[model samples]
Target: MGFPSLYGGLTCLDFANTVDGRALPEPEEHLHDYADLVRWAAYADLLDTETAHHLALLAKARPQAAAASYTAALRLREATFRLCAAPPAANDLALIQQGYAEAMSTATLTPAGTHYTWTLAGDHLDRAWWPAAVSAVELLTTDRLARVKVCASSGGCDGLFLDISKNGSRRWCDMGTCGVEAKISRQTARRRAARRTTP
Candidate 1:
């Protein structure tokens, strides 16, 4: 299947949300293999199409290395999710720290419109998650971290997202799915209660 819709607002949060219903008994995993990681990286705009295709080919040639990189990426994704959605552990912080350090070691500050941004040098296998590591660190250190929220959907969606709403009242990850499902559930319950009372 294709990757889930990007509703996390930030790349790091979006990365964390690759697994749906994280708190549920059986979570849905989107990234199945190295190709999935490459596809997701491209979809997330972490890598251009050309770079993504190169990585996919490289992964095919070096299956072991690609599997290792995919494992590390999943570790980073889980660490990021815990850090953002709950009180993080020391190991989570350490993993994120290592990821951020690795990313920065290869990053160079490049001029943007009015400021500079760190750009990764080459299209390494691990490059897929480098920007997400940097983003996670930047987000954790900022006040906007307070805006981070877990989806409030009762259907057990544990997706993480940045709630940039003005009033901070944002609840569901996506209004179309979780929000609509919740509304229908509540309505059905109300109707059931009304029928019980009438009879």
Candidate 2:
């Protein structure tokens, strides 16, 4: 589930609009980058999370939906980015919380309670963005503790994965990139050793 797809940056906004035919606002152009994903993730309200979760369900049920879920799945990119970024940004919670205030409500970002939470406008219910938004929150707060693995090449030049190992040490989303590079590097070292021995 960690490969590039045609709909790379479509986003939660795109997923909800595309599936339900209800357009809100488009995510910023650079949303594909990991940082934007982080903002999107924390920005998700309950409505949107549930929507995304159901979409994930749809993708699981209807294989063809995989094409679209690529963009859909990038929301998960938000959770992943949060996991990595939260540590560094932990001290900056006040500013982080300030930015999260939604237009309809000014829910304070506790930012230090070991979890994140927010309340969005109830009007978006029919929009039903809850599923996607909620799922993203769950991942950030409680769900993130679970183990996951993401693979990449020596320079992170390939696909990624969602490995859920118990010990949490799983790496390389796919062997094609990180796995192959390691193998090739080892082989090259071995050949170089053999040449020196023969001389």
Candidate 3:
């Protein structure tokens, strides 16, 4: 989906990568490729989607639920950057920014009491998704207030949080574990499977 949707996806994990805590290098400090952070952020969005659904339902009843909706979306963006900040190429950044903004543009705040409950009332859904545009500012900002993940220009490999150690000197998700296993598995699996199918 779009980045606004993608950003919401990251909130699922609440930005907690390690079950435990030690000195860890920041995600923005490494992982220069958008693929790394974007993928992880997208993974996080899967979790956020559920939370957003429940929250949206609650907002239907609760008067102050607008804040919750906004907060949840805000968190999604934060966590995505926390784990996978990368500097996208100019074209990629523009694409992501525009798409997310466009998606959010149709969002509307159904007046509740004091603060309006957000809803898709404009056009994001009519053609594709207009009603869900409440999440647009969640992707961008509201009343001029916005917070988003700024892609970095340099960093280490993907999932580096899992790679850093007790001393926190490591980079990459795992040089000894996932990094090597992936290579070995790819090399062995193809050869073995190819032989089994060979004449």
What do the candidate models score in CA lDDT, each in turn?
0.89, 0.38, 0.35
How much is the lDDT of residue 72 in candidate 1? 92
lDDT of 1 by residue, 41-130 (tens): 888888988888888888888899999999999999989998888767779988888999998999889999999988885567888788
In candidate 3 the C-alpha lDDT for residue 18 amounts to 18
Task: List candidate 2 segments past 4 Å from native.
Answer: 1-82, 85-87, 90-133, 143-146, 149-152, 157-161, 166-169
Provide the lowest-lDDT 10-residue window in model 2. Answer: 15-24
Clashing pairs in 1: none
Question: Candidate 3 on 56-112: residue-level lDDT in tens?
Answer: 444445534444433433333333334334443444334335435654565466889
In candidate 2, position 44 carries an lDDT of 40
Steric clash count of candidate 2: 23
TM-score of every prediction relative to native: 0.93, 0.38, 0.27
lDDT of 2 by residue, 1-199 (tens): 1223212122222222221101224322434432233234335432355544544455456545444334434443343344432333453333223222222252335465788755444332112323344433343354443432223345533222334556756555445545677788889999999999995
Angstrom error of the Cα, residue 52, model 3: value is: 12
Model 1 ranges with Cα > 4 A deviation: 113-115
1 or 3, which is superior by TM-score? 1
* Model number with the top TM-score: 1
